[model samples]
Target: MVDYATARMNMVESQLRTNKVTDQRVLEAFETIPRERFVPDHLRSLAYVDEDLRLKDDRYLVEPMVQARLMDVADIRAEDVVLVVGAGSGYACAILATIAATVVGLESDPELAKLAESALQEQGVDNAVVIQGEMNKGYPKQGPYDVILLNGAVAEVPKALTDQLSPKGGRLATVVRSDSGPGKGTVFERWEKAVGRRTLFDANTPVLPGFHKQPGFVF
Candidate 1:
């Protein structure tokens, strides 16, 4: 049997620490959560590896290090309400549940939403509510959330999602494309009623389908 506990420890020490995920709470959440359970049965053994795990369709579960870094940038708090766009299989939701007071996981794919609901229930994570909806719209009824996490890379940050953030509250961390290249991850924070966005790191992952930029006619 693969030792999940040992693997979790190694993941923290080797993958997260080396990549600058220095938050203690973030590290603890990553250490305790069983990432293997979130992946497909055939790919369970590869869970702890430092690579993005592809799902049934084009969606992907971001790598552990990437997630940890995103979580660190968000600075999740116990009293915070979180909105997770593109919940995937609920791995990121599960992790956020450990640190945030409440979480609303929105997944556009019905199949993935069902899977995520089942997985979260199996893990006894009651703090998170899973819903099937449009990723760009976000879960507005649950706003104003303290944090919003985008599960996959997007070319642009949707206005609807950012509108749900609490006033002078938290941040939104996501992998956004840059004009310079294909896959670039950017972190955006909302403070003092103004939004500040910046590129944090480079990540090559499949972009979420609906978030792609619309084409325009060439002159």
Candidate 2:
């Protein structure tokens, strides 16, 4: 029998801590949440691995390291409301719920949303709610959010989502990548009428359902 509890601890120390995921609150969040519960039972044995776990609906649970890095970069505060796009299975939402005042997990797949909501309920995650809808559109009804984390990578973040950030200090973190090169974790902060961005780390998270880059003109 796999001791999932011990596996979770090892993941925190080796995959997370070794990767410079230093925020104690974030670390504790990862430590307490049982990642296995959020994944399909067949894949649960590999839950603690340092890679993305395949989920239904063509989405994936962003790898543990990438997820941790994004959480650390977002700097979610205790009183902040957050929004997670492509929240697959609710693992990211569950983790963010541990730190944020409220987390709205928006998933485009109804099946995945059900799984996420059920998992969160089983785990007693009260601060977060999973809703099924379009990933690119974002759940505007719950806006504006203090922090927005995309659980998957994107070729380019939609402007509509950027507009959903809570004014002033609201930030969004995601892995931006292209078919031509490696992905990099980037954080975007809304400032009045502008959004400032900076790279956080080199990473490659699975791309969200509708975030693919449109092709450019070719010869």
Question: Which candidate number maximizes TM-score?
Answer: 2
Q: Which ten residues in a row are the worst by lDDT in model 2?
A: 53-62
Q: Which stretches of candidate 2 lie over 4 Å from their true place?
A: 217-219
- Candidate 1: count of backbone clashes, pairs at least 3 residues apart or interchain: 0
* lDDT of candidates 1 onward, in order: 0.87, 0.91
Write out the backbone clash pairs for model 1. Answer: none
Query: Model 1 scores what on Cα lDDT?
Result: 0.87
Q: lDDT tens string, model 1, 104-128?
A: 9999999999989999999999999
Candidate 2 lDDT, tens digit per residue, 49-69? 988888875688888999999
Q: What TM-score would candidate 2 get against the native?
A: 0.97
* C-alpha RMSD by candidate, in order: 1.5, 1.1
